[model samples]
Target: MKLPSPVQWIEAQRKRGHELCLMLDTFDHKPVLQTLLKDRTHDRYSSLYSQTPIAELAGIGPFLIMLDSGDTQPLTELLNSPERHWGWLVSIAAQDFPALVQHWRERILVGQRPDQGIYRFHDNRVLGRALSSMPPEARPAYLGPAHSVCYAQGEHWLSADNRAPGQHPLPEQPHWLQVPVPPEQRARIRETNAHRFLLAHHQVAYLQLAEHRDPFDWLRLQRGRAEGWGWHAPRQLEFLLVSSLSTPEFEIPMQWHPRVYEEPSEHFERVCQEAKLLQGKGIA
Candidate 1:
């Protein structure tokens, strides 16, 4: 579905008495950090790592910046661009920025049992998947001070709201929260592995695949298909999946179909070459 323009969206939020803010991920790209610092103002903003043991890493960590009128245009451009993946735009019912910062700072470290680590919850993909996997009642733990959160998903913005009836903001600072790795995030790790592999070794195929479908869903489906075929090696499966992206049909050749354990690179190359020829003829 088409979303209202960012200007319209923000105007509507302001009319509803919500404070606008952005949770930016500098680790994704330096442009996000630069944008935040370039427009540095007296308006409330805090790095999620500030006042923490990793304070030195604040420059590259997640930052929560309350958006002001001057920030609309540049931020809107970034928010609307799908490839930027800067972070999420948030609307909060209250103007207590410190409380919102504290809410997220407490969740910086999360884990399952003895394996606590820096949670990349700031990444919209990770957050989106995590929210979808949780029961409605448990969503507020993540929603915290935000009235609603929106992030770029494919060609549109996806919003997740606190579903509980009353206000459910968490302002207290909790350290080293013991939260399990959401099943969706674990699956995303594998999916990203395949995507990174393609970007590194098969740029052409990566672009083609991205143009064809949502890369996340496509990679997940490819992983499932590979597993079902009993091709259990991670590297080999990645090769199979990425190689298929360059071809028109995106299927393994019949000759390779008989061999369950062998690498399918050779068969894939032949198919990819034929696909290129077809494209050259304007038939692909």
Candidate 2:
């Protein structure tokens, strides 16, 4: 599919009631570039990654560039400039931008477990045999027969501490075990693994850059770790572009696993509470 220009895409989303903002690097002047270079040298860092060149851009306000039909030069310049580095042209809704940043910051503060709850779907016989062989404590939560279209609903049950079988329950005592993952879940898992791997490798480095800290060393370490795991830098960059953008239609794919389930966003509950408190204060 041919993608719309960034401005056109954002405008269309706004017309649909999505309040969005665009973030891109803008070192349009030599003075700004000189200052950034001086700061970078003073920090005494070597082996800086390509993306690190535009690290300062995250601290400043976003640039709202206008585009015209057949006006591809600016976009091309932004993408191909050797002197200027740009991360993904992230177009996030205004409301979600803060929450998303907070989420990434929290992830950095407390290191994340990328493979926490990944699970592979199996046929009834296979799952049943595995469950029968395992002890009660080791068995997965919410065991029941498989359903045609209940993987998402089943996730709710799996996350809950206490769950019971409903009217049309599966054979197993815990109803959740019977909930079958959709066939497409496998593809989603692979996509999610690729996404998380990229994020896990670069998130801390990105966060450091955002804070205007010296992240060259950190970026080097991450690069080595990623290489050790047999990941290609170019492929990782492609994943980062997609994963970092928070447009209305984008969904962060997830994987299923055997760990205790928690909602991916660590600050979701806190953000909800703060919103409610503000709403209540307004009402009063």
Q: What C-alpha lDDT values do all the predictions have? A: 0.66, 0.32
lDDT of 2 by residue, 188-228 (tens): 43444344443555565345344653333434443443344
lDDT of 1 by residue, 109-187 (tens): 5444333445666777767666666666676777776777777666766676765423344425322133355667556
Estimate the lDDT of model 2.
Answer: 0.32
**TM-scores, in order shown?**
0.56, 0.23
TM-score of 2: 0.23
Q: Looking at model 2, which ten-residue stretch has the lowest summed lDDT?
A: 145-154
Deviation of model 1 at 27, angstroms: 2.3
User: Distance (Å) between predicted and true CA of 279, model 2?
Assistant: 58
For TM-score, the strongest prediction is: 1
